[model samples]
Target: MKKTLLISHNREKLLNALVYFSKSTRFCGKTKLFKLLYFLDFIHFRETGRSITGLNYYAWDKGPVPQDLFHELKQPDTDLKETIALLEQSEDEDYRLCRVIAKKPFDPKYFSRREKKIMEELSFVFKDALAKDMVEITHLSGTPWDKTMKEKGPGKRIDYSLAVDGSKGSLSLEEIKERMSEIKEVTEIFGDQ
Candidate 1:
């Protein structure tokens, strides 16, 4: 069956918050972490109309660097180029650590060993979220596109796909609504299932 996915800014906020908390020293318990990750995967399932793999890829590919980090770097006085260079010099596992330290006003050494350990654990949260996204997308691929022809009619096919573009980071509700309305207009013109 053909389906229409509705994206929501609230859901995106929740996911972003989850990522933030996962990396935070205050909330990195194993049980709570898994629960938050799964909840985010469920949101991805609903918003994109894709299965869990979509959430996995979304988290894996786009989840690491929070949107706020970029915003902070964009400030007029911020030394973005130097900070990026420092991040690049760090090992893969330490990239987020470098980023967190760079964004905050405190010294990097101020983060205790325990806090650093929490950050490492939180990295897995990111990985799991990405894995869920991938699984959902892979499931969708199994649904043959051509089958729509025989099942729904000759012209019936997927008109648009709900793909996540993380390059822009999370969007506001107004932005999402505007895009949804635009898509609704197109669907009306083309006829809907």
Candidate 2:
């Protein structure tokens, strides 16, 4: 299937985020990386009604996972392989570290000011935290992951739109609704460009 403009943009964002976290964090593997992306997207979504990466996460047993990117990591795409690499997990680490080995340095051009701020915040907050710790965070009650696992069952696509209903680190429900409407309008306007 062909990717939409937003989805294509998401891939680049993901790559840059991988590099950012890889450089800044103490330990980040696939599991930790997934949680980071989940938190970044959901937090931003809750605040601004948009995900940093237009990724659709699944409520996997571990936590929320962006399955499309998960698969891409499994069988490294040629372009991606040239830019990044998921190193083999050592006995010491819970997950394999994603390394940016590309000749081209990380570019933050695709990210908005808010997006970059969120990424930096996530990296700082979870820098030394373990993958299990990140998992615990995602598994919190009332979160999108919890709602999906309890209401829709696991392995289902997590409806991140549900994020607007929560109160923690979130705007008021009424405000969220307004942002959602504004985002929808903007998306419709720019979707085909």
Candidate 2 colliding pairs: none
Q: State TM-scores per candidate.
A: 0.22, 0.81
> Which candidate number would show the highest TM-score if scored against the true structure?
2
Candidate 2's displacement at residue 33, Å, is: 0.7
lDDT of 2: 0.78
lDDT of 1 by residue, 70-158 (tens): 34434522233322222222335633222222232323342335433434554554444433353344235322222233345333322
**Model 1 CA lDDT for position 94:** 33
lDDT string for model 2 (1-193, tens) is 2433344666788777777776777766778878888888988988777787788999999899999888877777655665566665566565445433433567899799989899999988998998888888889998889999999999999986778765676777677678768877877997622
